[model samples]
Target: MEGTIFSIIPALLMLVLVLLTRKVLISLGAGIIVGALFIHDFNLFGMVKEIWFIFYEIFVSEGSLNIGNILLLSFLLLLGIMTAFLQASGGSRAFGDWMIQRVKTRKGAQLMSAVLGLIIFIDDYFNSLAVGQIARPLTDRHRVSRAKLAYFIDSTSAPVTVISPISSWGAYIIGILGGLFAANGITDIAPLEAFIKMIPFNLYALGAVLLVFVVAYFKMDIGPMRTHEQRAIKTGQLYDPNQDNIPGDLGDTFKPHENGRVFHLLTPIGVLIIATVLMMVITGINNTEGTVNILTIFANTDVNLSLFTGGLIAVLTNLLFHLQQSKPKANTMKIIIEGIKTMLPAIYILLLAWMIGSIIGTLETGEYLAGVVESASISPSLLPFLFFIIAGIMALATGTSWGTFGIMLPIAAEVTSISNMDLLLPTLAAVLAGSVFGDHCTPISDTTILSSTGAGANHIDHVLTQLPYAIIVAVAASVGYLLIGTLNQVVLPLIITFAVIIGICLLLQFLVKTKLSDE
Candidate 1:
């Protein structure tokens, strides 16, 4: 099954099960078991052993403790505790009350979420998690659905970070481009310059970002997203009440005070943002040799460790604020334990996602897909479009944009360099765009899961609701790539892409009627 069409069966099966049953854990577990069976040549004992090794490797890689995975898990738990602290301290309610006075409409709440997503461009993980904490209060007050908030967070995170020069995503991509340029003997442009040049040509990213604001401003809810939005507006139900095991839903574990201060929420989250950025720079400098610059710092920075440290600091700060309440001191340890309990669902899903991702990699699923793209003898004018579609499909299947980048970007570069060197940057840009687009639509994606966790949404609801919106942006961006391939330029194609997105959004808003009864 390795490096063949059969290797893709497990992913397809997982996807179909997710849509049919809406059970993330069962679907992922089934995928892992099936893929392991294929890898073990259908021997039941060998398949079980392969599954055991996959789980084992997640914690112990090459006889060493996987600090990155452990720290990332810790950060998630810490974030959950911090969320509990905010609620118990009454900070979230207080903040929502304050914002409710100013942001009187759902549109304002949604756009604010989108803008915050854009502003927090340092890392997609941080952006998705932190932005949700900050914006959830306001959005909920305005009756915005958790699914919609998750959509906003997921859509804005990777797109903004992937394009920004100072972000972790930008640093990693620039490093890859530098090596690609060096290997191809292309010296006409610097890595940073090439990255900047590629930004406009990254049609999916630009279109996705723009579409968020348009959707918010125009209430352009279509497909499954419209159903969620209408439910939110009509009955104030933010998500499907029937769904269980939703991440970030802490229930009525603690009562909030009437006089809780907004600073109770802002202060701790502020500490988290500042501390994480500082740690990133400090760690990046320590790992970097020679003269240090922003790019080198980000390229070498320990993101998982930084996130863990930041999360710890924020949790402690939140605890202090919780302690400052009236004379009666609650059982702080119990509250913390309950907070950690809320995150168990998220952690379980994340662990299963990792195991399945490992199985897919072992099966060489992405390699098989990439090989198919590489073998196609398409014309140079269709290279960008073809790469975009293939990269999207590959990322969607593997549920890892970074892994897709690792596999598809090199293949795209090699193909373009051998035929039309002029199409290199556009091809690379399309790959990045497509990877982000696909990542947005996949249930198994880490960012997708985190977005739901942050917004306190059902994971399957987030995945299904966001699919149409992502596909819309992807289609518009696909058209732009087609034009870029034909015209060999960026400006006109991007302008037309934006126009198409706006046109589609407006047409939807005008045609789709919401049957809302007056209160």
Candidate 2:
């Protein structure tokens, strides 16, 4: 069952249930149980033990605490508290008012979120969380749906990071490319150079980033996103009233001071950004054996540790500001507890996601998918398009882009080197793009969950609303790959892909207009 077609049933079942029921935890739990049963040959007692072991390994690995997972959880909790502190100090309100005066419209707010998402290319997790904290207030003030904000954050984070040469994702990928180059006896192009060249071929990432700006600038609210946006604009409701257990909502926990200043919000965020980057660099230096370079540093950096340290510092900074507030009703301990409580829902989702992901790993689902790709009699011409599609499916099933990268990149390199060396770069780029695309669409994806948590949106709402946008970009990218594979021309195919995206945007906008006129 481990590497057979049966390995996919749990993921497929979980995905279908999530779409039908919109219950993230229950769907993930069901997937975990089903996967565990498969691992234990459907024996109930064996299945129960497998489940227990999965939970145990999540917290304690190899007779000790799982420091990485613990730190990441700590970072999430601290971020929630920091959010509460920001709201309680009136910084979020003040920032919203300030942006409202200058931004003037929802499009500006949305574009602002996209641009910030692009600028913060250090790490996807950091980008997803930090951009939401800064841009949420502005978007909310303009009646932008939390679903849209999550979409903006989710779309830009992975696409931007995957392309940037200095980012964590880029570093890890370059490292893989180095090993592949050495293994294949290809020395003409350096790993960094290869990555840079592949950037243009990463059609999905480029299309995703472009689609974000186009959607924002043109206000092309398609599918379920339009429903969320209309609800926001018409009734000032950012999310569905029926949707319960939102990840980042603070509710009525704390009252903000009237004299809150913009710096109050910016200050803690500044601390978070600076502290996180500083810790990343420091950790990288410590971990590097020799010849410390930017790529190696990023590749070796302890991201969880850096995030935890940054969030801790930021939380303390926000606490200081909160203490300065003259509100008589604000109790320090109570506010912190409320903030922690608000993040518990997000934590539960994340934990269950990890558990299901681990179960999928034990079931060897990705390995099964990759085996199918390896055994296929694919033409070299269709390798780019096929790789893109397969990588998407692998990431979607596994709920992880990095894991997909680890599995697909090596296989892609080997296959391309044997068949068509000319298509090597395109194949790799397509894998990167597809992995990010799948990451954007899946509900169990960590970045997707974080995007919703950051935007204070319902987790399922973010998944559903963002799905159509992801599919649109994916289709355009698939066409671009098909063109490139068949014609072997970069410029023309890229131009055609961009045109497809623009045409779709315009068509959707026109349809929206016609519908509104009808109404």
Candidate 3:
């Protein structure tokens, strides 16, 4: 508990190691070990023992037996099973075939991919893999670059989910805030109510999602993305010239079964989404004695529990109905196992993210950050705007939005009570938006890695091609946040934020057009 600025060293070491080695879990483990060593004053044996104890605490501590986390993991695993079921059942194949027939142009394929990205809002990991698996074949048929496909996937994954109430990211954010509220004994409003208000104010998420649409709609690929797109159109080359190392088999052939129909895919997905909503309402209304406001219903809604139930029901339907018609006719057991296997990397990343968050918490990183901000003696309104940038930097440096959110949201949220009540929405939005901006673009982010794998694109190529676009959108979002934070009294902040976003994007599009013409 006597940590100084030196406590920041472990996270910095983790970030640098992850960037250099591209091994996130190893880097995080190294950080935890190093942090423990630093805490124990450089004793190697003690460090090893402390590391063991950390694992034990995460797994076995009474406080660690948290239902929110367990439910989050369960929901994640269930999504994996459901996605695998779709693939193994030839449902995704059938659905792809149906879409490919209508999508003959490159622009159409990319737009449809964006639409699909919005629909798969249950989890960012699910969105990344599902969109990539289903859309890659269609995008390839239209000669769209894999880098662009990865961009669509990455942009939509974390950014869209961060803003959506029904996603894994929202669940985690609410859970984190719930703990903060309990700690501070603030019962005037629920965390979910606060989160819902923050939704329309999340400029980065909206900007990033809309930016994906604008780029796809106009086919104005800027910088490296433009190069990749041109190469794809002219030479039919999807990967970058210097990047060709694909580490996994991004192999999903579109061989629809004789018995398969679009219903095979559509029905299960419909069940999942509908069930999730119904469960949320039923659980929420029950919690609120059936007479509360929409805000309260949203606040009381059980995201992790609802998602788990929805995913479980959806996967069961997939196994029972769709798998029987696919090639090889594997039994339910094999299909279920295969479905679960697809989610291992994501689940592992999630667990490690939690561990890293715990390590950062133990080091009091947020307290240090809050102290630094307070010492700056900034004005009240300027603080929310500045915190948005701060959150983005933390997220980008750590390569994990969950870690960033855990380290920053409580400190940022605490400021709301001391300031204007209206300030709560933008500050919450800032935390969500900034984390999403970093997650959407960071090369080491799990969703970023997953998107590349899913699109069969080179990881570095995906990052390079997408980075310029992310930066443009991030800049636009930062300006939008500044306007919202400072000028909400004159006009509706959310409306102004979006208008600024679109204007910035159109201006950037023109710049890209001029640059390409000069080239």
lDDT of each: 0.91, 0.93, 0.72
Query: TM per model?
Result: 0.98, 0.98, 0.75
TM-score of 3: 0.75
Put down candidate 2 lDDT per residue, 304-395, tens digits, no spaces: 99999999999999988877778634788877888898899999999999999999999999999999999999999999999999999999
lDDT of 1 by residue, 418-501 (tens): 999889999999999999988988888999999999999999999999998898888898899999999999899999999988
Q: How do all the candidates rank in terms of TM-score, highest first?
A: 2, 1, 3
For model 1, the stretches where C-alpha displacement exceeds 4 angstroms are 328-330, 514-519
Badly placed stretches (over 4 Å) of model 2 are: none
**Alpha-carbon error at 173 in model 1, in Å?**
0.4
Best by TM-score: 2
Instruction: Point out where model 3 deviates above 4 Å.
Output: 1-3, 56-59, 63-85, 117-137, 140-150, 157-201, 220-259, 282-294, 326-341, 397-428, 441-466, 481-519
lDDT at 481, model 3:
71
For model 2, the local distance difference test gives 0.93
Identify the superior model by lDDT, candidate 2 or candidate 3. 2
Error of 2 at 29 (Å): 0.7
Each model's Cα RMSD:
1.8, 1.0, 5.0
Which 10 consecutive residues of model 2 have the lowest summed lDDT?
A: 322-331
Best by lDDT: 2
TM-score comparison, 1 vs 2, better candidate: 2
